[model samples]
Target chain A: MTDKKEVFGMRFGQTAGGCAAAVLVAAMLAACTSSSTSSQSSSTSAPAGSNGTVIKIGVELPLSGGDAANGIPTNNGVLLAVEEANKAGVPGGFTFADDSLDDAVQGAHDPAQGAQNTKNFISDSAVLAMVGPFNSNVAKAEIPLTNDAELAEISPSNTNPGLTLGDDAKKLRTSHPDIDSYFRVCTTDDKQGAAGAQFARKLGFKKVFIVDDNETYGKGLADVFDAAFRKAGGSVLGHEHLTKNQQDFKALLTKAHSLGPDFIYYGGTTVTGGGLLRKQMADAGMGSIPYVGGDGISDDTFLKQAGSMANNSYYTVAAPEASKLASAKGFIAAYKAKFKSDVGPYSANAYTAAKIEIAAILKALQADGNKLPTRAEVRKNVAATKNFVSPIGNVGFDANGDTTAPILSIYKISGGKAQFVDQINLKT
Target chain B: MDIFLQQLVNGLSLGGIYALIALGYTMVYGIIELINFAHGDIYTLGTFVSLAVLLGLGVSGEVHGFTLVWVVLLTIVTAMLLCGIVGVLIERLAYRRLRNAPRLAPLITAIGVSFILENAMQLWRGPTPIAFPAVIPNPSLQFGGVEIAAKQILVVVLAFVMMAGLQLFIYRTKMGKAMRATAQDRDAAQLMGININTTIALTFLIGSALAGAAGFISGVYYQSTWFFNGFEAGLKAFTAAVLGGIGNVAGAMLGGFVIGLVEAFATQFIPQGAQWTNVVVFSVLVLVLVFRPSGLLGEALPEKV
Candidate 1:
């Protein structure tokens, strides 16, 4: 009996050990296979057999996280621009290649990963210009690193004005000093938030309740909107700050409902409980009141997730509607044919940013007598961008690397789609 | 007073969910002494399964009346059955051999199983929170000043029925006696001809079915479900189990209700309480544990010679 028990124990121990080893091996293999496949796809998509020198444009975005809903479409827009540029050829026989990196850590944008990605791009000599680090917080972590390298970084979706101006900008420049290295296609939140407030006032909403996701982008927008709305003679009923990724908002909504506001404004992205908040607000008998948000909540994911509750909600996007732009016709058609999906909120901005970067690179190459210009020369050319017409509109960078488009469009979610409602062109 | 009453209703409905999930943790821990961390993911899987069933039934758009009732009943039954089978499979494949090994081994395996389920769901249905079909109408009824929704009533009533049914099964059946015998003394029960594996598997089945019910009800009530929902809900339910007494079913239920009420009132009254809700909930757990180590209902086990 003792011998039988000993044999049984030994066999069971070996089986368990073997099972664990098998699991480890399987997990490692899955990781390896996934990485290899992604690299293979990126390489296969590049233009083949070009005799020109290969220059890479690194696109950093949260391709796999909660922000992927925004990042993937933005990346596609960048890719489309790169493909168009390569087919048309740059000024100096330079072939543009897109090297996309995911700065998402465990399904959300991580600043550390963004910094590391920037360092990798800065270290690569072939990289001429960079297109994105989608979120403003990610850009905050990456700007100093790119500035140290004097690499020109253009963002397609970052909207926080503090990234380009204000105390945060001062803090960023105090260490790096090369503040002009960063630029974005989207207009700043100061303008967008004011526009949102203006739109609300036009709709005759006197009392508004404000809620923010408590992130850099959300809080800044909420503060600006609160000030602007009050300045426009609208009364602020209440303001609340919610932590990101919170699923429950019933208590907050209940509190807000008691205030009896004419409208509710959410300063947050769709991923971080915006859709849930809207749905719950509707469920709490607040559906008749108008809901307004910034560009963050202007994605299809929000529309689908919010379902019937999405109706009557207003969102502001920094870029004009793509279909309305005559220059965007071909790009939109090609995008639809290739991706089999509607062009998202920031795709036009991304396409515009990529084109501007390519235009600057071409200008630098031409200025350098058909040789690849230094990173500093590229930065100077991008900063000197003037009257560069693209799909979205005229693109130019001000002294502080802010877009000078002066255009913000308001969209209403009607019939489960973002339909263009109005445009406010600020007199700059 | 009306606001307080409304919050109280919300607290009870939310507590019912935590209690259902905590029962899974308490029962499994009672028998195996292993905190089955994967129990939460099983709950998530239960939600996804029900989502798939609803989608497959072509019950999209607005469903109503007897049809809505049948659809919900079908979803609950299907999710419970599927999750029960999944629970048994996980125990047999991943946990059975580790049962006799060191305690740390099964604990680690439980975590591993959790990752596997979470990732599997993430891969199957992308990482985004999918909208759960709102088949049940959520119109509120006002009584005096208190407001109550139909979904909240369903959640609380269904939870209590399942809990009562589980208690009855554990107390009144021959299998329940065998399970009690095994939990009391595994070797002695085996010597007395009770199949140890069967009893353990039954524990997993019942626990997982309760988790499934919780998941289904939550998906309906919240109108959303995601892969990571299990992680937060699991942590809260585990705290509930510990707060009640890890091995006591009734204690787990009471602990869940207390935690829920605490969260609701804290969010309502405390300034910026939404930001500090988790802190307040866990602090209560710590205070409870510090004062009563055996939990509110748990009897201290006699020290072995």
Candidate 2:
């Protein structure tokens, strides 16, 4: 019996040792392959201009994961802007090429992979700016690295208020003091959340139950909504946090039903429990109550997943309706003709971000008089962007590196599509 | 009181599903003395297969009445059969060789199988949570100011029937006797003319079938399933198994229901319970293990010489 115990212990030790060795080897191999691939791609991506100067803009997005629905369209938008810029030509005659990187590892936005992609972008001297990282969590990881390198990154759809300004903003700045390096065309959660609260009050929902996916973006938005709703003379019945990607919300919904709230508010994207929560709420006999959410739930995926339950739901988006904007008509038609699909949620914002970046690059080039501007010069130009007109609206960056034109468009789900209801111009 | 009763019904329905999964964990662990960690992924695979079958049968957009019943029944059967075969194959290919080669070998192999199954499903379905069509039309039956949906009824009834059937099969048949004997002593059972390999395979087959049923019910009831669904469910079910006594069949079932009730009541009564549901459930496990180490129904197994 003693010998048997000893042998068992030995075997356990061997297994642990073996597993450790295997993990270390796998890590090393992954690093080696990623480095090699980045170098090869960078070398091949350099397009030959008239003067032999090629500039690349790194596009980091979760191209093949749960966020792919948003990421792929956003990538296409960036690609379209780059195509147009190449055709239009920069002042220095430098060729613009897109070096798109998929920061998704194991079918999700992995922070380590996002950080690695940032490093790859920083290492390549010709790459000037980056546009991407649809999800706020991925933005959180990539921002610090870009900040340290003084590389400018503009996200089309990161709505977490903490990333730009607020108490969390101060915390973020303390970690990476180069806070101005990160910019987003998309409005923050505070504006969207406050807009949603005002809309709820406008719709006369007195008591509301809030549920969040408990991630950085969802929880932050929910907190903002909760505070804003209370301050607006609306009573909050209850607040609940749910695990992301959780299919079942019956128990939570059942509890919510008992409270008898006027409506339900979800703070998360469609992929992360928003759609299922709506469906389950309907299943729990709350089908008639209107559901409200931020821009995260303002997508075709939410409409498809929520099915019939989507009818009375409302969501807020940072951009105006594509049809409403005269400048967006051309981009929308071109996007449809090229992609064979309607422009997704962040595609227009991504296009606007790319255009903004291109305009900054042009400014830098013209300042230097037909000479290539340094990355720092490009970063400065991007920060100083003001009164620049784009397809979305008048694009500009404020003191906090947030968009000056922060418009929150509310859409109601009717006929299984998000229809424009009202628009709120938020004060920066 | 109505709210409490309503929460009870909700808890029971959720418990029923967990009980079904916990049975698989207990049964496999009882016989092989190895925790089959891949069992949850097997449940996930069952949901995927059922989803594919339902889609193939063109059961889309508001399936109702007899057609709904038939489609659901057929999907469950197909999912169970496929999952059972897969389970047996996993046991044969992976666990068979490592049966006597240290306890750690089979355990590690089970985890490895789990990763393979999860990654394979992710590749096949693309990491996003696919909207499972609500095949079972939800019609709540109101009684005494409490609401109980048809899906909950279906889940509870089917789970009880499966559990009863499993109870009978394990205690009353020749194959069942062989299985019991193998669980007691594998070499000794082989000497008594029992086909040890077949008995072990049968154990895996039955356990996986129950998990498959669980997967089907959850997918249909919740109207969504993702690749990582199994991991969380598996962890909870494993907790149930340990709570009930890791190797006791009845204990596992009881533990599952207990955990389910705990989670439901926690969400209903505790402040911020929805966020603390997992915390409460695991706390119950810790408390139970502290008070009753051998589990509520577990009899300490005789030490092997």
Candidate 3:
């Protein structure tokens, strides 16, 4: 009986110890969660010019992971525009407050987290306008949440054609019900893909190897390019799929080399693929062959990763050269002074996005005599915006909140930097 | 023909390193009958330690170019010794306590230890691939019509030497005899006054030391290393161990060599279109299991009544 009692005592002791350990771990996690979140609370509020009223706006960008290369620049540009807006002052003594989140971490890719992030902004009530959710998938997740809350969101870099146009290939109808709270200052992937295909065909490449990193934007753009390329009487050698985080690509490269295509078209971000593709292509002794990628690989980091072979890669993007846009000179000068980091391929689009949002907000605040404008009113007013001239040129949303058929610029590697080659207007 | 041969030689070189890692898995399972999931991570940890040693010795791409080789060798030795100690410690803390417990207990403990090691590694090294400086610039050796790499030859030679040493020690030494006696019948061997605990620790020490050497070589070859490198490589090595016939020493070496060669050949054969090299490897494994349940060389022991 004493032995049994001692055994029972030891068992109880062990169970209590396990429970204590579990609780300690949970407590540590809770502590970390609280402290990290508190540090982010030091986010700067938009300065109230002469009056004390400021509108705080939240912007989500992927600043760390696969999308970090472009997303960080877009975020920086938005922040720069916000700073400029505060400097100029909103018409009736109003200032813009800014809250930034790094969606580049794991949470950014998850649609559930994107919806939750949108819900968090909606509940804040202080956030009158939102700048982004950089990737198209995140944009898709956030659109409904924003629409439900009647919040206005301007995406600086999302290029999915379906965001504005529904699954059917027709232009978005306001009465069709699906897209009201979403607006993008940037041109969609449909325009960019068609331009890339035309450029590839013009280059006299009859056979092409199409590859994608299997992402929301990468695959969608690849599908567009492939269809257009095929219709142009070009033989698609094959479409190869490479995954993210895979370092070894000798097998894929060797296979790609075997197909003996004149050119390779990659539809993906360059975080993982750039260096591997470059190194492998060089090893396969095909370093001279030209490869074209989308805006995802149009950054300097991608070039750095791709090494010397980056010299042969070209990308198509929406932004025209700063010299080409007469009004963009001042915005460019201010942006360069404000941001110490390298300018992204889509920095102009970001500045334009922030400018449009500030303009709509200012217009709404001016309309009311003594009453403060609610977020819902701001959303309706921003949607109804017309003849709003932005830094990039004339910007006005159609019923679907998309830019009126903008042109895309083809950028080629000239002396290690993406220089303007030509511009194709999708409107034609 | 030259490029094809060159790629083949490169494939062989990588195969040798995989085989060495696979040997570590086979030896540990051969003695204690537990798959040491932490073995590959031990290899990764060994590489990190080697990097610290290289940096500590002032061996960088910028300075004392050839002397870096000596520093790398020193680092490899120190890493192997440290890994050997870690292996023994794991046996004492985890497996030893579960010696008389259910079979599932030790397996679960091994998995738990693997996760603990992986997460701890992530904490130590941030989630980024750090480039390791190459010690030997002249890794190639041209002979007859084939140009063989010194690093590849070194890996294969060292792997065989370790296996031979292990084989001799097991068959000839007093501790080896005791280990075999314990493995064959644990309680009976304990009655005969053999220390089962020491034998188990010795097995882990030797097994982990071999894995440590392979890890150092792997880091040198790949040029980049990450915290998660161990998990993927460990899984491959485990598969190699089982393919060769788990708990069989010779079978492990054979399994490692076969898996390495087949993976290389699969890359050569599989169309670039589908990209099904990994799928092919798993498919081969399934077919092998269906045909030979006891593995290539594994023998089924008769039940004692």
Using TM-score, give the best candidate's number: 2
lDDT of 3 by residue, A1-428 (tens): 22222222122112111222342243233323333432263253434254346676777655544444455556666777777888886665566866666654462245556667777788776688888876666676677678777788988766666777765313322332553888887777666677888888888989988878666566767888999899988999888666444455554555567668888888766643644465457545467888887776665445544555668677777545444677777776776566533345456777777777777777778888624577778888778777667666776778777887476777777456556687766654
DockQ of each: 0.33, 0.42, 0.18
lDDT of 2 by residue, A1-428 (tens): 22222222122112211222342243233333333433344456556544257778898876664445445666778878888998886665588877888877886666678889889999988788999776666677777777777788998877666678866555555445745788988776667788999899999889999999887667777898999999999999999998544456778888999899999999877777888889878767898999999766765556667888888998776555555678789998887676555565567888888888888888888888978778888888899998778887888898788999887778788777566798787765
Worst 10 residues of 3 chain B by lDDT: B296-305
The C-alpha TM-scores of every prediction are 0.77, 0.80, 0.74
| Model 2 Cα lDDT, one tens digit per residue, B14-125 | 8878888888888888888889999999998888988999899987756878887889789999999999999999999999999989888899999999999999999999
Sort the predicted structures by DockQ, highest score first.
Answer: 2, 1, 3
Which of 1 and 3 is the better model by DockQ? 1
Instruction: Write candidate 1's Cα lDDT for A110-135 as tens digits.
Output: 77998998888888888878988777
How does candidate 2 fare on TM-score?
0.80
Instruction: Point out where model 1 deviates above 4 Å.
Output: A1-176, A189-191, A243-245, A325-394, A426-428, B61-70, B299-305
- Which RMSD does model 1 reach against the true structure? 11.0
Give stretches of model 2 more than 4 Å off. Answer: A1-163, A166-182, A243-247, A299-301, A326-382, B61-70, B300-305
lDDT for A192 (candidate 3) = 66
